[model samples]
Target: MSRLTRRRALRTLAVPALAAALALPLLAPPAQAQAGRNVRLLVGFPAGGGSDVIARLLAEKLKDELGGANVIVENKPGAGGQLAAQALKSAPADGSTFFVTHDHTVSILPLVVKTPGFDTAHDFVPVAGFATFANAWAVSGGTPAKSMAEYVAWVKNAGGGKGAVGIPAPASVPEFLVRLVAEKYKLDLVAAPYRGSAPMMADMLGNQIGAGLGSVPDFIDNHRHGKLRVVAVMGDKRQAQLPDVPTLAELGLPGFEDLPFYGVFAPAGTPRPVTDAFSAALAKVVALPDVKERLTAMGLSVGHVPGAQFGAKERAYSAAWAKVIKASGFVPQ
Candidate 1:
């Protein structure tokens, strides 16, 4: 039994060891890339708002794809979404936590709010876009303004002098659009900032505000209920839900063409592989017929942009909104 036999056995063992090492990644339980345990989709808005609706939709689909892992939708609505942005910054970047918010939370808030917790370009990574919608200008049924032309004329020559317009949040997309409209029409349009869309809708219904600017979905049902009248949409084209309502361009105001986008984002430093997996999952979910139909029914267009494209869009939006916010003379609260 000698040195030759012992050397032959050792060489035989080494061959299998090298092969196992080479195949380690392939055999590592599929890397748990789908969902690495508990995942939370954080929304920086109230439960009943449009952002929450999108988050809940994505959470339901993500839970199914993440191997039964719990996917929770946590609402941290405050400071115009800075609370949730800060929460995302503090969360572990192990792919378990994410932020789902619209362009206002990600792009406009930081520009208007002093020290808005996290930097959009530096502290967060885009996963995928959920949906995009345009803002609509609507008046309460009690208001005499039934169309854009009427609304502008009423604001300019009405007895109230400067007509007050209710906006969901100050420095948001709707607020900016309202300002642009006022400037365009030379109307004395005073902006009234409300906490959320619900309260603003209530004010509009109660006749406390002359008009309101917000997401189209916020007022579409009410408009159908005969409580409000949509004047113009801030989109390139008319929204399908309200086909009769012309866009701002059609109404001769083309500068208010910025469409708001909603997207999923992870805390910065999340692994690239994990982000990619999440993006792929989200793309699949948005593509589902039922999901698409549900979103369409809610007056949202089913436009799912990939991670890189979404990130670029977010950056561009930030830059564009920064200029708009600065020019509008909106100081941080």
Candidate 2:
């Protein structure tokens, strides 16, 4: 055929090719399963703390699981995790930003703080939850105490019936635990509140504080190294990492096995599709061997609860802490 004829034929085919290309997207599934938008994982505590570490860990792998969208960790440390929790209330109700926080911000702080800045029931929606952590009542290595019984006796003998135990946050589960255990065992004890676990562990290592009630991550390594002795853990069972360690229930503190949960939540107005997508990705993220290993090593029990169950768990936990706070006469600050 002539050059002109061939050129006319090529133009005729190009029109149909473009039309087919445009129709492909209509036939394809909605891209809702993969949150292609950028994601921010907010942490309410300083970097290197347990909450921060877990946030970073899950965020690191979660982005890949959610289709390689950029996921970054933003630290908004203040008011014992209230700042970050409050930010979620105003955050865009999309998959773009979410908070990775545990019970302190979700369940406990709101009940304990006079003005916590946000309401859990209305401000946020749980997406997925897992990794319940326990607070260990640990004593310094210099003290001659290997068990809860011995630790109580040691505090009684050395400090003249007055002893202090460090807790990372003022209005937290660990702080209330100090009061409850002291009242239960009839020991003269005070709760020394710290800004975070690092400072509390520092004092514990230097023997400035005779004992501490902090999460497993704060004291696990030291306890393993003989620098500190964990008297009793408060998780569902003795940690596999420290098989010899006793759980609070096993050590005779009944009804304390179920501890706090680490969860991800979005603003209350976030769409169901977005929240569900994140939860599905997170379920896979937590099931990863490396992810589970790292979290378990840091003293978290790897598990997953869908949004509804997680929300129920949060409410139940708040109710339980409410009783403890009231019993302790802890006026909210």
Q: Write the per-residue lDDT of candidate 1 for residues 105-187, one digit (tens) a residue.
A: 88888888777778988999998887888888999888788898888777667745488888877778877777788788776
Per-residue lDDT tens digits for candidate 2, residues 176-250, read: 778778877789888998877777888889988889998888788898799999888887777777788888777
Over all chains combined, what TM-score does candidate 1 have?
A: 0.87
Q: Candidate 2: global Cα-lDDT?
A: 0.83
Off by over 4 Å in 2: 1-36
Whole-model lDDT values for every prediction: 0.81, 0.83
What's the CA RMSD for each of the models? Answer: 4.1, 7.3
Model 1: lDDT equals 0.81
Clashing pairs in 1: none
Evaluate residue 12 in candidate 1 and report its C-alpha lDDT on the 0 to 100 scale: 99
RMSD of 2: 7.3
